[model samples]
Target chain A: MNYEVHNWGLNVGNVEITGVASSSIFLIGDNETIKLTSFYDTPPDSYIVGSLVPLRHPTIEEGTDNG
Target chain B: MDKRVAHIGKTRINSIAYSSMFEIGDANTFTPTSRVIAVQKEGGVETDEGFEFDQYELFSQEPSNVPDSLTVQQKNYHHNPNIHVENIDVKGISASSIAQLGSLNHIDSVSRIKHIRILEKEQNQNDLIE
Candidate 1:
């Protein structure tokens, strides 16, 4: 009997992957003036983000529901 | 002739006496005198004129009664892109192996890894107001 052994096999494992995923950023600025009157009146629950200057008549009331 | 002469002499003597007496009386009694006086007075008058004013009454009513003349100022804001990392993952994996048989069993292995990255950003901003 011939005493000879041949081991032929292939094994592959342990893989590593790396990457960089970045995004761009943007910043915006705004400045504005608003006017309130009888016809185009401001809402009662309006969110004010900047300076607000309101010009109102003496006889007229603010935030009155005319509907 | 004697009577005519006597009459003429008597008439002349009478005329001469009358003329002399009248001249003496006029020169003695006729003295001229004159006097004058003046007065002045002032007066004033005043008048009153009528005045008229048209009184206007202004009343406050409901907003529906008033005319719609008010306007609203609208502002259009600029847009900016907001970017951020969306996803990061391994795309694929590849592996290969070689077998060598000289005296003992030997195996050599190699692997090639791939990766993928994704980025996302905002194209427009949301509506701020109605």
Candidate 2:
């Protein structure tokens, strides 16, 4: 199944697809989206994962990996 | 710090362990036949703990009291996580309800709905609330 999540406020968008239940694709930053797939199998009990690509400022990046 | 965790390409979750873990200080309401999370581990109903809701008990509270069409969401926060709030299960919940809850953090949505149903269910078992 394909799910398209649109935010009413933030321009951020998320698209999740089944079949590969392991990871999900997310769009972060302006014009520069980030895709986190199979990044972390077992999410940490309480810790930050994932990082911002390059072009965008590090602050505008995400922390968690599991979707 | 509100967090956002999503599958890079896939929208579905991998494990059921990290289901819904809503934090306190969220928006939620309840009414007769109106479903809401009944039980919370830390915060009260005033604050949204992102608690998951139990559907069976929600409807059972007043099965005859027809369900109403409503919308419930969390208040805006400076730091919000990319939470996935959707009822994966084909629960008795109406589609609109799911969508409303789906807009917020995954954990909060579930807790808000499931918690109440769970409480009501237990009440029924003990003959507490009719």
Candidate 3:
């Protein structure tokens, strides 16, 4: 395979982002590879009336590896 | 990638995650993993078989919902990137996330989160009585 190379002036004005969350990334220069995985389970039945959420405590053994 | 002058007027990041990264130059590899499981109900959701950390599950088996891209897999990737930016503003980086300003070689991130909320319109359950 044959490839040609060209270099040109790269310019940008402004960048605005609200959030980079939950295993997300914000890069500014250059990268080779990026792999991001996210799993969200917010059931519709769970979201009710108000904005309050009563979190539960997981019941695990003392010696269990909670990694 | 070509080398050139990189300029930025301002950069602001509100927050970073408990397990996250913020780099300014360059990185070889980045691998971050996050796992979160939540359940809310009178007791709990039940089925014939339970789920595990190393396994995959769903409340109901829906083929369209859970796609193949979301599934865990091992693959190879290649990239050729270059950028010039100014005034970057980010809100937050959470759940094993990364924020870079220069250049990166490779990045692999994983996040597993599960949230289930089950509540009645009227609050009924209590600690001492129902």
TM-score (0 to 1) of chain B, per candidate?
A: 0.14, 0.16, 0.54
Across B96-115, the per-residue lDDT of candidate 1 in tens digits comes to: 21111111111122121122
Number of the candidate with higher TM-score, 2 or 3: 3
Model 2 per-residue lDDT at A49: 52
Clashing pairs in 1: none
Tell me the spans in candidate 1 whose CA falls farther than 4 Å from its real position.
A1-67, B1-94, B97-104, B122-130
Model 2, runs deviating above 4 Å: A1-8, A14-67, B1-10, B18-130
lDDT of each: 0.20, 0.28, 0.65
Model 3: TM-score for chain B: 0.54
Per-model TM-score on C-alpha atoms: 0.11, 0.14, 0.58
State the fnat of candidate 2 relative to the true structure: 0.00
Q: What C-alpha lDDT does candidate 1 achieve relative to the native structure?
A: 0.20
A1-67: candidate 2 lDDT, tens digit per residue: 3333443433224433332122221113211112221111121322445532324334544874524
Candidate 3 clashing pairs, residues 3+ apart or interchain: A46-B117
**How do the candidates rank by lDDT, highest first?**
3, 2, 1
Q: What TM-score describes the B chain of model 2?
A: 0.16
Best-performing candidate as measured by DockQ: 3
Clashing pairs counted in every model: 0, 39, 1
Docking class of 3: acceptable
Candidate 2's displacement at residue A10, Å, is 1.9
